[model samples]
Target chain A: MKVAVIQFPGSNCDQDALYSLREDIGVAAEYVWHDSTSLVGFNAVFVPGGFTYGDYLRCGAMAATAPVMDEVRRFAREGRPVVGVCNGFQILCESHILPGALMQNVNQKFLGQDCYLKAINRTSPWTERVEGVVRIPIAHMEGRYVADAETLARLEGDGLVAFRYVSPTGELSEEWNPNGATNAIAGIVNDKGNVLGMMPHPERATRKLLGCDDGLAIMSAFRLLPVN
Target chain B: MVTVRVFVNLKPSLLDSAGRTVTGALHKLQFDEVADARIGKTITLQMEKFDEERVKAMCAKLLANPVIEDYSYEVLN
Candidate 1:
């Protein structure tokens, strides 16, 4: 599968994402600048996490209006798969590509560690290859996901809830959540379930060097399912 | 004159971890009157020349994020 990882100014993790996907996962990946207008024939587009625009005007706010985001939105609407990790998730939220905005961590600290995630919608294209519950590393300060009651209800009812916080034993729990929340929702897919925005860095945890292989299952989703 | 009011907030489905932290802090401080606290920002900008379409463009393009934050403005001529 052809994968394109977007690189914007101040995007520090683009190489990490590219190396992991290309060398580690054996996926065809290229680093695309944020100014590009067309994604061309790429099968999947990966928005890597980083401090886009130095997180100056609200994390992903400035990066959302980038030239490439136009194409990103178009591809997303066309039912192509797009995966956003960390800051990429922030950009997606800012661009209105996905619901919910990432806020400051509940602990008010930059959290960098391996996190456990309970697979909420295993039937979706992003999680179809993953098992019941999985472990992945999440590294970010603005990782908390939030939304209103009506929208949250709609997302829950529509099966857009893709992953939730889980205990070490792989049991879902709201209290043990890294970020404070009622459902401990870690990640969510769009209404179409093709565009997925996740806080956890599956690319970071894709190899043993990163201390886990759980990301393989998540990244493998690209290979398992054809782009919708 | 035109006054634009922009309300910025976390989207309904995303998590507000910072909001929960502030609430917890209030409880720790023994503030019982506070039930829940969600942090948000409201900005009021006054323009000498009022153009609804231009103001809306500014709001949609720069002032607010339509996805996570909803913004509305009124013109006082």
Candidate 2:
């Protein structure tokens, strides 16, 4: 089960993802440059976090139009798992693989801290093994998730909400929402449940030396998915 | 040559923190008459042909995120 970690010009976390998948998760993984036009052999694609294209125009706007995205979209259509973290989430939204836009945090500040995320839906393979609330580190400026009311309702009705910010007691509240994301959403999956885009950096939390390894549950779940 | 000016703003339903901060600063400067302040972006594009449809497509596809923002454009020849 080989995974492909896409590397944009400004992607700073590609190596971290590669390490987490290759060393920590003991999975075969490789980096695919943004300009590459094909993604033929990989069973899964991981879009790691970073300031892609120096965040030109908008976060993930330019990177979303990269040559590799076309092939990424094709891979996604084949029912393969595609996970995006942080800026990766923005690219997914910009590419329309997921509904909603990640606007500037309501506080209008760059936030970097450990946040609690509740697994709202465990049906998807990505969250099947993740139980209840988990702590993950989030670092970003434009992570406030927003969508139209109809789309939001559809996402809720379809059970596409994968994770949401929650208090230490697992209750949802505005104060616990670091970015003021709508409904305290921290992550979401596509209608097919194969594509996942989330703000937290799971790769950064997979090692014990990093002070936490709670993120391994999600990665372990993803690693166990059947390859197509 | 035609110049297309695109205006993009966050939808009224969403809060604009940056715009609100700017409005607060303006109020402190005694611009008390300002009822409300909303911030948006304007992009000026130079095109060889005046193709309204193409410009609209550009705005829809890239200039603005339809999920959280609205966009309009004016063509100046």
Model 2 ranges off by over 4 Å: none
DockQ, cand. 1: 0.39
Which stretches of candidate 1 lie above 4 Å from their native place?
B1-48, B66-77
lDDT of 2 by residue, A152-189 (tens): 99989989999999997899999999999988999999
- The best candidate by lDDT is 2
Model 1, A28-144: lDDT tens digits are 889899999989978888999999988975889999989999999998898888999999998998888998777777778898887888788877778877776688888888877
Once model 2 is optimally superposed onto the true structure by TM-score, how far is the C-alpha of residue B77 displaced, in angstroms? 3.2
Q: How does residue A91 of candidate 2 score in lDDT?
A: 95
Report how far residue A75 has shifted in candidate 2, in Å: 1.6
The DockQ-based CAPRI class assigned to model 2 is: high
True contacts kept of 1: 0.50
On the 0 to 100 scale, the lDDT of residue A71 in model 2 is 87
